[model samples]
Target: MTLPSRNIFRYKTETRQSMHSLSPFMSDDVVPGVNHSPVKAPRKVPRSPYKVLDAPALQDDFYLNLVDWSSHNVLAVGLGNCVYLWNACSSKVTKLCDLGVDDCVCSVGWAQRGTHLAVGTNNGKVQ
Candidate 1:
């Protein structure tokens, strides 16, 4: 008992014909009610960073947030036992504080007004 051979070409032609009869747009050229204007490509973006800062002994701990950007465009970074403040506008780096050899900076944060910065140390102290 052998099954009848199927004609793939004939099946595809029938399917195409049925689809063309059902849809208003038969050909692949254009849709029945749509504009076919050329679309503008997006503008190219710079691959490199605008600026870079050298941060020595910056902690790579997952739970610690050692870097923070203030609303006044100041960047606070905790590097080992010292916390430094970098002004984005002037590009000036200032030494905010040093926790000394006994303590290491854990995290750094800026105040809401961006006028003050808080530094947390591993010795359970906040400066």
Candidate 2:
């Protein structure tokens, strides 16, 4: 004997009214005016597929550094006397700062919670 559990269930086609009836959150107050706006073509800018630092703009010994998301959302690298941060998503260099460094950055790392930045330099004795 065939059991009811072996029966195939046909999916019921849902109508706009039926869907609205099933959920009280749906409303029928959609705009009724026809849209006269022109359709726009999809933008064709190239996409960068990387999400992490790819060393695309390191030019010096890599020293002075800070994280300013408005500049480089991913990471801000300080290159000796010149500091730069790149866009985290596009890998584009966004901000640049110059430090009067006669040498490379001796110390650079994220702050305690990674929400802030800290940098150190060496004059001749201490780093």
TM-score of each: 0.66, 0.35
Cα lDDT, all candidates: 0.84, 0.51
Model 1 per-residue lDDT tens digits across residues 5-124: 586455544444343455665666555466566888999889997887789778788989899999999999999888889999999999988888999989888999999888888988
Model 2: residues with Cα > 4 Å off, grouped in runs: 1-73, 101-103, 124-127
Clashing pairs in 2: 64-78, 72-86
Quote the lDDT for 16 in model 2: 52
Best by lDDT: 1
Model 1: lDDT to the true structure: 0.84
lDDT of 2 by residue, 54-108 (tens): 5544444443343334322446565555556565566567444555746544445
Deviation in Å, model 2, residue 44 alpha carbon? 28
lDDT of 1 at 26: 64
RMSD of each: 8.3, 10.8
